[model samples]
Target: MDITSPDNSYEIVIVGGGMVGASFAYALSQSFGGTCPSILVVEASAPLSDKFLQPSFDARSTALSFGSRQIFEALNLWQILEPQVSAIHEIHVSDKGRFGSTQLTREELSVEALGYVVENADLGAVLNEKLKVSNHIDFLIPASIQQISPTPGGMDLSISTESKRFNVSANLVVLADGGRSPICKQLGIEQSKESYQQHAIITNITFEEPHNNIAFERFTENGPLAVLPLREFEGENRCSLVWTTAERESENLMGLSESGLISNLQASFGNRLGKLTSIGEKFCFPLSLSIAKEQIRPGLVLLGNVAHTLHPVAGQGLNLALRDIDALVTILKTASENQQSFGSMQTLQTYVNSQKFDQQKVISFTDVLTKLFSSKKLARIATRKFGLLSLELIPAVRKRFAEQAMGLSRKF
Candidate 1:
């Protein structure tokens, strides 16, 4: 709940109360039940009257894998979020103008839905409301961490608000800030980044035909394009589009008239969902693979994009981060029960050790998919063709691929 009077210390302090941070806080609180520790969340931006105006709750939509849905169900959040989501009954993957394509269906996985897509704003509203009602959490907004330093016992932080600045200490600090973090830079954390020299053109588009709850992943000579199904709006069949293209090409696409853009999209995407009727405001950002050099140190841990940012090819970025939150919360809960210092290297290392393989696998999977589909080499083209054919022809191969896409391969 909101705390009017600041405390000098907290058992846990979370930085950046965005999606990741808020999820972690809620999960941690639920896991501990009545014995929950004193938790504080410091967010730099105040909650806007309209969630859509918030940076974290903008027009973007996130594709949550089936496994991610299970995670939310465990947290008791799925019931509240289900109404705002569109379920994916099937995923269609193809190479543009290629000889092979494959489809993954919910029946094959024995699940009702393969995944669900929810607009960021809707998801943010649910999480923020939960934060405000949680008795164990002290929600602090319009507050910034001016400085963070290590102490013998834990970490010390200087927090700034509109009225005053104050010092607080915490046994552990969780950093869920976005990829571009000034605090990380101040703490001398280095990131290894590899730019793909491509920018993703993101916008919502209306189609003449219904999507039938099918998400499409199409690879073209330009780059990988994803069209995720969204709930109908105002009687129009809508879908979220992520089109990756070269830097120059993205600029050209952004400058096109709505009709011109629709024409170009029709040529690239074909008539799978019929004609593209309309386009929304276009947004673009460069693609990259960024991993922090260190995710865990004494008294501090990095979570979400602050730790690793991946390509948007398979829609794995947020799903993977959600899994990370599950693992971290479990480990911290155990530490709390055992009365061990959760911020100690031993405790933090245990969390890292448990998640190391999962993190690497997802990172590698996303990176490889981005590179494989982005290339036009003859050999790579043949390889992908065979890959798709194999997925269709072989049940074992199809099952394995579907598991990864549904985020069931790793058990958190």
Candidate 2:
């Protein structure tokens, strides 16, 4: 089955050229041949968008787990990212509930570091740099898909840019288009989702005391607050923060002036790291968990936020997306080599089967943990607090939890 437009031909067409999509494209390229898989990436943001590739004046950053670091290393993208990455040597987790508190240290697990803290822009720049040098992938910058339809053989995509329209076809179509996946909606892939009754407010902060490579997670009556360490700020130490709270509370916080907000934060957060005198402007995202009931369809598949978007409370969203990239690359490489129909129902089903256990495990774990911690119930509050307190006393349990945060749990 030749799934290609007569004018422009390709073996795979990936929608949404964000980091996840780019990673998948690069992975498939390497698996098949250094420069073999004919691919096209359509991104709402330009494939070569400066938003991520430029320097990091942005307040946004992400905590990359060790498992994700290894995956990037395997993909040959980490070396490019190393300079901008900051290692997380320790983590402190505590809950202000009816029970007690807990903390996890990297030394307890005999690991060099728990994970790495990196700005989103830096990671994107590194990935874009690699994508530019790759001979295998073709990036369709700043393009939008107007329509997507399944053909008897594979799939058809109609993409429009400012100046032109591109009609593309591929043996397999990957809808990496994000949470509100237009392709999935076009294909009628059902999804099950729930709201977390919270919002995550992200910002960068310059602390009075040096972080000293320690990250902190403090849970209050509102929601969890994560303070992640950075390498060096100008000449002092700084940290990135993700403060989760209810929508109303989030709005009120965001409404404050920088100094006012900082003052309020210092009050609840305490002077654990001395005074937090300054903070970058705040960004807010509503919290929700979404899972596609069926990630694969007749001629298309979903990845990243499109397939499953989880609560950022655990910071596993991108890690899970990377796992999807790995599985898709493996399956596609084998199929392409065997001359098998890449878009066949059989092939898509196999990819879905391989990902089921791992995907479900992550979604369930994050969802349950988020709900358990967010509950205000007296009983649940006590149990969760006790759970944290108990783990604090047991060295082994605390180590295990840290290992999990490092993305070294049973499931990848």
Candidate 3:
């Protein structure tokens, strides 16, 4: 749909309308409070009625830390999305073939829940609905950015739409498409990537017993596996499973029959919730650590997975990106109030500086968890046991771990 008038330009343009990009649009519009700059969102694909149509919002589930819930509350979107989520009241962590384990409860953290797990489809529906009702956002869907050229005052984007080809200029361009964005490559931005030689199998599973809203993180020789609580389906105890294993192993498991897979899963993860009676669709993809070295430049910025894609071991990837969006909104609002160039290196650098610590800390934490838990050596096992016990024995250590995992330690 050719909605934009000829010669019309925007003050800011968001290249992706995925979760992070949509959240940034909403947060920025809310920050301006009806007196906002002209904003445009160029989305390559139409808003999919079936969430699985989009890779970013699919059959998988996401764990929203308490801090993320608050951020949603600030934007007034939490109430609409809350009922679709299953609260994570407690977290149980263990190591296979080991003796040490630890537990984190909401009571210890003084929160109603440690986190909430919601289907990717549910979240995508909420975000799409919110963006639809927003008057300040001009979203162009089924469009792609053919090329990008940096201008003195702003950036120029050559966008290809179904109807016609057009060019738009914006004072600021936010690249939140994803980690593997071709737009980044067009702009000459380079990302340094490190592959883990592992893959995660994601699916929704049903168990015989009640999960009691407890999330489980089990370390195995293959990789870190997580089972997050999900809302019950048809009176069955449901959970979202992320099982990490070597690439070849993942391929073999994905080809097995449902019964065979369930049997194997039960072996790795004891029958904590009794038998895994059934499972929904399955998805598997190779895991890696991709970090864009340069995230900001004059008239441009990178957000979300485009900036950094982390291992799923900690469920901190999206949570960390939301935090980055929050910081960018704060910086942009302040810059607007001061009449400074929001896309200037000075302004963008401020955001980079403010979020550096939080980003690095989360990245380091997840990386360490992957390397430590992925190990099968005696020393690594002993260290992991000590780590688990420390979390159990020391309230302070537990508190810090919980706070970080809950996305509390880096609140904007």
Candidate 4:
């Protein structure tokens, strides 16, 4: 093995620079009192200065729950990201060709807006921009981790960039490199995956009428469709669409012409937003429930999709991850203040324990919703109707449901 001298060592090192990982780095840096801990973030994809390739930082839109908004504001990133986001004043959820439907509005929840939708690429730009000026964070892009070894006091990592190879050691290694990361596999971190046999076709579609900042989540015969409102571009009413269907149907849909696909969308999602005028390019990806069986091991920890990948039914994937990030940052800041070994099993376990409940709750909720709403059985249909009705008519139930959708749990 060609082991060279260490390039540098850090108190903390994040293995990915996607949403969750990048946010954690910034949050941790901002929370420090005086001297911030030395932090390093390694990303395989090219930096924003070049061509970025991380799927998590793509053209697809991500819904930021109200709680996620708070996290950003607290980190002082909201100002940079707010311009690219569209506020979701209301969420209309219904079963296609069914009688019962529910509408959750910001007014009813007593919030300015339920959530905000921002393009992944735009958010990435903001994050990368911050990284460029971050004094405490050493951000490296177009780099990959070849191997990781647990050390007595910390962890040693071998990374490759271009034709160069180097090593770096850190007290902790945060694995936020997305689901199905080979590094996690190499570490023998078991993952339990439940394939949904579904694929989501995501795109942006312009509608005839203004979205009026209203989002729609309609459960159809094939699957669920979400139309999240977007900021107007040149006075055009736009919305980001996530249409989930069977894998086979998704393949067929991808081949359809723009007008054909728009027709299919209009058919599945009613005329609530008037006619579909135009659509951007469509992209499809499989859906599943994949959770890391073990989140922490000695000097290593998992974050973002690496820890859990959920169905995007409730737009809870990123929201839940952000919440977990918040908890991890809280724990790490306290550990730093106390001069504790942040990589110790005890400190890492504290993070795992704190994030365990929220992770499970959100995962179970999304998984159940995926199965329940995807079914066409009479009993399931009736249950779904009841679910929507209860969510709307009952005050207490509505509040709880709203809290879940807005990512406001007890932890917050």
Candidate 5:
């Protein structure tokens, strides 16, 4: 419900009501049913309206793994999201100007689709709409957490809205505010960061031919270029593009004319989707691997990019965050059943411990893939070539690769 002023206390307070924060609130509320805890979501930005658009709900699209689809299905949101998503029946991975290439198909995995792609705005709309009407959640938008301090029983938060400022307390405080989190710093949480020294150029491109529900990941000398299929727009075939390039090269690419940019992109992407007909507004951001040294402490926990920010090479960042949310919600439900404090050290630790392996594996996979594919060194190139060849020739290896890409590795 829309809250003008928060209550004095809550069971859980989530900072930042973006995708990650809102998803957790919805999932937690559903999991608890009638015995739901008092949850408050403090969002710094205004909600999406006819006049104002939430920045998080920009034009960019996210590739949701099959596992993420399952999570949303369990939450009863898949039906609402499915209509706006483009299913990926197959993924084509190749090394530009190289002999080795591999393809992972849904038919081979015996699944409906490998993954699904949805526009950020569409997904955000669904989540935000749910938040506004949720009976168990108090969503405070266009508000900020001015200060957060740990208490013996929980955490105390000072929040500021347009007309008023108030203080509230929670048994558990979840930090989902993006990577640059001042609250995390205030709480003395440190991050271990590694800069890839690369920038990702993102845009949507229209092609002459249909994509056939295929997503392409091509490793070029510039960096890893990904073209994921998108739902047709105005009767035109379109796909989302994320091209990772060096710091210097990104500026040059972003400065080119639309036609010039398409020409360069066509040269790198080849004729997979026929001619690249048109391009959208371009966006660029520096790539890096950033992980918080402490994800859980006392009555506080970190979620989303505040916990870990990864390379976009494998498109694992948001998917991993979703998995983390699922695990935390499950653990909290168990704790509630056992009559335990939701923010106790033991409970929070259990949530972190349960997701450690999955988190590590995905982080390592994305980091290594980014380095290996982005490097021009002879040794790295040779290793990747052999890697692709193995994935293509060996059924067992291919299955494992496909499972990871489909976010099913944890199942086995």
Candidate 6:
């Protein structure tokens, strides 16, 4: 129980115990009950804090779909997060070209809300707190993997802390490491990394209106701009904005003073919601489309950001990751009940096949949407205009897109 010591071995080893890893661990613990399997989590930093404090309240946030929220509830972490979460009740999509736009309401779909937004730190804290209460899960705070090797029947990992080295062996090893995962590369799994010419500038802004649980997404020549609903204090309403633009423009925008930045935002975006009164500190991230060529290997499987990193055009990156987790957990449940080896090639193949369609759907959708919205070529521009017009005119197509945006395309 001492933070100074490390567990010697485990039946399952997870690398990168961030939100993604935490999700898998929580699910596995629940599905198998406390007596399930010996598990150890090797995280990038200490259990709670490395560079940031617990519940850091950092600028990063995610729009979790209703489906994903259910997954959290199944794992018992949602109760801890629900109090801090902000529900998205409505959404509007528009474009600035000849093409018009379409709007969607939760009422149209007969759903309580479109989605929920929660701070990244709050989500992480909830997962870690559950792990703390789980006697079956061993928390390796502030450790990194020094070596990973595949044996004939199992995988071996050597992890280290400042004071000592620890050896861990698992029948199955899951890579939940974030994008550009060293574990994936070390296993010689190929990845397709397509760098984009754009960057996303993310920040929180105080709007004149209360947002009223509405989320706005406007497509522009540069890229798509999204305003997500968020809550700061008990009585206040705010929106978390992720605006994608060309690299140069993003740099310029990040450098602007608070007032100047608000002015520019107001100009680019008309007063539909009223003026932007104030802005929060801005953060920027390079955009890219990354998908692993292989999703599984002998005694190893990849999930989460380690599996695929899509552009944030629709904010479904994490949702897609949760889907992967959902499918994998289902496969594992069946295999365990049938007394099958979880890391066997047969089990791995089943997990891979179950996820093939969903993964392809998300990657392809984001790729095509980004290219369509960011194009400035005359032909491409005209095509997007017509596409937008179609969306406005066709109720069925608009509903389909809206449902997809709400992360309801697949029932699971």
Alpha carbon lDDT of residue 109, candidate 5? 93
> lDDT score, residue 77, model 2?
74
Off by over 4 Å in 3: 1-7, 48-53
Clashing pairs in 5: none
TM-score, cand. 5: 0.98
How accurate locally is residue 372 in candidate 4, as Cα lDDT from 0 to 100?
Answer: 90
Let me know the TM-score candidate 6 reaches against the reference structure: 0.94
User: Residue 405 in candidate 3 has what lDDT?
Assistant: 94
Residue 132 error, candidate 6, Å: 1.9
Model 5 lDDT vs. the true structure?
0.93
lDDT (tens digit, per residue) of candidate 2 on 25-52: 7777767775366777666664335554
lDDT of 1 by residue, 208-249 (tens): 999999999999888888999999889999999999998999
Backbone clashes under 3 angstroms, per model: 0, 0, 0, 0, 0, 2
Q: Score each candidate by Cα lDDT.
A: 0.90, 0.78, 0.88, 0.87, 0.93, 0.80
Clash pairs, model 4 backbone: none
Error of 3 at 175 (Å): 0.0
For candidate 6, write residues 1-412 as lDDT tens digits. 1144555556678887777787888788888895578777777665336224232224678999887888887877788888888888888778865557777788887888889998787777677777777877787766788778998777999888877888877888888888878777787899988888799998888877788888888887667888888886655557888999999989898899998889888776668778787787789989999888888888889888778988888888889888788888888889888888888999999999888987888889889889888877888777887877777788888777777777888872
Worst 10 residues of 2 by lDDT: 1-10
* Top-scoring candidate (TM-score): 5
lDDT of 6 at 361: 86
Q: What does the lDDT come to for candidate 4?
A: 0.87
Top candidate, metric lDDT:
5
- True lDDT of residue 127, candidate 5: 90
Candidate 1 Cα deviation (angstroms), residue 289? 0.6
> Against the hidden true structure, what lDDT does model 3 obtain?
0.88
The full ranking of all candidates by TM-score, starting with the best, is 5, 1, 3, 4, 6, 2
